[model samples]
Target: MSSSTPAAPITGAAPSSLCAREPHVPAERLVAEMVPPPRFDSVRFSTYIPDPNQPSQTEAVQVLETFAAGLGGAHATGAGRRGFFGFGRAAKAPKAPSGPRGVYLDGGYGVGKTHLLASLWHATPAAPELKAFGTFVELTNLVGALGFQQTVKTLSGHRLLCIDEFELDDPGDTVLVSTLLGKLVEAGVALAATSNTLPGKLGEGRFAAADFLREIQGLSAHFRTLRIDGEDYRHRGLPEAPAPYADEQVTRAAHATEGASLDAFPELLAHLAKVHPSRYGALTDGVKAVCLTGVVPVPDQSTALRLVVLADRLYDREVPVLASGVPFDELFSEEMLKGGYRKKYFRAISRLTALARDAKRLVR
Candidate 1:
């Protein structure tokens, strides 16, 4: 629960509240927003700073650059120019390229896999509309919203599809995406994905990928996995996150900053439950900063996972977060930290810590 006392209200501008938003994202908007989020919007291969000690990082860049080059001319146009939802007249399907149809980046978090992935999205010789980049969750959500067949029809004409943070925890999602990818591959679409787990090693602790070996094997055959080894780059040499601010300070900062959303942490979590996870990005639309009071450890797994999605969306939009109470690192319980979703929790902490640091400038 948050503190009872409220901070003094601002004189001029009023702060927005995330708890007040219940964004409704239409299917067309979902299709449009599939491109890279703001954080990586302009990131190109040249911008990636590889760790000199990690040779594989550089090797990945070289291999991906060649891979992008190979997808030139005929591959880029994808048989013919198609409008949104595959409306344009179709031409003969291009000859499917021999060898691997895609690249899979297998590495630990903060190893620049996403940066490399987005760079490949940018480097590929295709118009922005012809290439798509999004998180694995977003991809699944699109399927849920548009239906599997509609999704295939929508993306099959695309030259490339890049998925980040590919998850293998849910056996259903693993199988669903595997079948989806098979259809897309056969349509001559190139693919690239980033994940902490290797394709063959997916679903190790949670569910057995071997149970669906035929589907998993078909998906794996399309990708040439590149192993990148490195430490978490976000904290490589950065200072520790600034300590949490007082509740009054956070609220005051929120009111003073334009386009900021102020909310009690618990209340915000409750609000998230009512909104679909697919609309999380839309929920944060135009929110320049996020301010919360009574920040505490998440109550349960479901709530914690929702927070992870929200954190990813906020980080994608480069929205700084100002908060009071427990630090981001302590938001998950010890048992939860050691559980199957630890990577997600850790990634959330890393991103939230960075955003917290960004919020420091907003404090008086």
Candidate 2:
């Protein structure tokens, strides 16, 4: 027979010790802390500076307002319900005029489509239960995690769903999105989405002959498409490039930054693949300055996804990246565009271009 182990004496402060009590926090304050407003904290309409050169930009902002007004209703308080859930005096006020139920904000890379979508969400005042904001990639990822029907049912409660980077890179994703969009609309959910290509122009150059076009056609009808056109915002006022950095530097021991350089593209990718994002981010924490070489077209979907994470980290930290094998704009090959993560690729390209451009400018 085994003897039961005696419990150890409680060695820490007594339960009734004066230090044991947390400072008195009001119950109301505690409840408030538990629930917060939907994200998109960075984008606000008030800060969107209209490019004096592009008259269309002013119109784009107006479209964003209409999208926000539709779901938020008028006189909605707390920066369009982005803050506290409290129903203010205006909550009793009569509803404002409703606006468009569906809006598609289209533009080329770096043209601020995402900024507009974010602004609309932050400026709208849907009830806390009736609003959500996320990217197309995130939606697909969530569907993968929770299953399609469950995700749809969970999201259906929201009156407004703001999406960024609506892409059609895979037939499966197209089917899923079609079903989801159709159900959302049928349930009275308003959509405000941003994309690099117009609805009719989606899946071009990649799945041009795919049968999913029929579904896209049906979904497209729900949105009032608006093209926000201009030069690629990334290319404006960029610094000149220096001579290409040699690839041999990356093969050296200790991965020296003698030239303040980056590792070979393949090696960098291999390292990135082995770690999770938080660790990957920590690894690159000190990589404020580096040059990238052998930057050929992205080889595969997995690599492209890894590169997206790398690009996001680098961009957030304002790291300087120089390159050689390929231009930043041509980072992905035509073949890679057909993959399900094309939206991530597009985002990677935009971010890398901006990072490289800014890095050069800072160098000069």
Candidate 3:
């Protein structure tokens, strides 16, 4: 031990030997230990499924690489040596691009847009202080729970923010999200987002294009919009899976067998609203399977929205859903399907159609 090191403090629980060893530990190792691991450690570029047939695949790769470079700070170029000592002098620090640039990935459902966003989030070398990843719903929920300004304050600490499923369905959401993105960009937070809709056409059939455009005007200015063209990967040949529920037999539980059915009428919407949007991606929770009997028309816009969130969760988790009321397609009225939120409904249909096809019926 260094002579300058002080005697270790005595504690009842900790041994004197252990306390004494702390002084011997290197400061550099301690500093390294203090640095936390990346928040979205599970996502990475290597896990992204790339297709050579997709023309946008190359552009996507370049975008991620360049974004990563920007996060790491550009490397200084050519160096000239000095006279007498001939010691190499450090080059000037390259000026970082002025403001954070965002990338918006637009594509059809299940075209791996979210996967690419995750890859970018994972591959980017961001400081722990400057990174966060959340679905658009989750982030909106965050804003709802925490006021817009507070949410901005919390997220602005990060240099990069990655959002999945970035769609503007609600009028209020259009305003809130537009403001949030503007604030984030102003705060120098780079954004990477995945969505099923393009910028100019967002909230198209539901709200006035002028209003929606005004909302996203700031985002449109800074974000480089890229279109990802591909077929729906989730719609491929599906296997015949077992039923989500059974006949007349009734139960209040979430997951049930062939002889037992789970009530879907009043409870499904309740359950959907009960969970946090951040958890909407995994709303099934403890259930191994799910079946809904007494399925009826989704009455209001709020309920339809809740169902949209639920369907997204079930589809992402590959949870099968069984219904008894209206056909899955008719669950939402034609008006609702043609309304402003139709994009969400369309996505739900795409997913539910696949789920229903694979779902089994319980034998009486």
Candidate 4:
């Protein structure tokens, strides 16, 4: 952009020549640094994404636009746009704009639900009532630890939530989701989420069970549903490009920011709990690097481990971890990974992505 700017010296050239460089610089870090930390203060976080999910972000916008317009039936949405992310269509039921409870994206795995949700969250800034939550499944972990009623009370305070993993694994879980969602809508909290199942898709697929539908009915009454179908994205692997927001980046940033005075996770978690009821319980090592706080209980295990995992991941260029809860744990019990860490990773990304975007500006 600026031709007048001095060109960078050729590699292996004399060191003292580069003004941006100093007398004593680590050989490793000296190699072409990340654009010299930018001039003037920048967003507390880094904005120089090696590669951004622009295409994905664009598709997400289209999905939200369709949903926002009430393009399909009010309640039931027809399969409209199909892309790398998943399926999207406008719904018409409830007779209300998608604004009431936000847009609910429901469908099978390998669909671009999370990608779509991220797009919607980033673009729908005009609707202040539409608060985009990073993940919905994490709320479940909290609900299991804390009573659901209180969690609802907290979340009802917010206007919107962008939740991922909408399906409830436990039956008791369904009731909590039902009650919490019902109250939120009554109190005017619009909602949105990306899921691998349909509204009544949670319960037994065997009979298209009635009870599941009933529970989903109350919540469904206030919001609309969209189904994504077609070939699973997983059938094909992702292409290489700009580095993704790796858990490592989050952990690295968190660690880099560690010190006497800093914005801690407590505040972030509390805000989240007030919006969603599922985050709870705490780990023994109060030294956790990351965590979702402000729930009835706390997080299980130590919050630090998630940070550690993220920290290790931060250095890895292959799989970038954009967002994370805690960067403390590197090793997830095989069970945790199989059960829902897969789901949790997406949740982390959604959360971090929101946090990063919400910031005034990104720094080195």
RMSD of each: 5.4, 14.8, 17.4, 16.2
Candidate 1 lDDT trough over 10 residues, lowest sum: 81-90
The candidate with the higher lDDT, 1 or 2, is 1
lDDT of 4 by residue, 1-364 (tens): 8769774432321211011111232322211221111121131112212113334433444557654443221222122221112224233333323333556676554455655555444444334332434444455544544456755655555544566656565557677778877766655454677765556455443233465678866655554666555333433343322222343344344344322112234443333333212212111112222312111212442342243223222211112222334332222444444443334433333333333332212113
lDDT of each: 0.86, 0.60, 0.61, 0.40
Q: List the residue pairs that clash in candidate 3.
A: 130-158, 130-159, 206-340, 243-360
Error in Å for residue 164 of model 1: 0.7
Instruction: Compute the lDDT of residue 351 as modeled in candidate 3.
Output: 77
- TM-score of candidate 4 on Cα atoms, chains taken together: 0.42
* Order of quality (TM-score): 1, 3, 2, 4
Deviation in Å, model 3, residue 139 alpha carbon: 1.6
Strongest candidate by TM-score: 1
Q: Is candidate 1 or candidate 3 better by lDDT?
A: 1
Candidate with top lDDT is: 1
Q: Which regions in candidate 2 have their CA more than 4 angstroms from the true location?
A: 1-40, 73-100, 127-130, 208-210, 241-264, 271-294, 300-347, 360-364
Model 1, 161-274: lDDT tens per residue? 999998776778878899999888878788899988888766666666568777667777878899999998988999999999999888889988988889999999999999
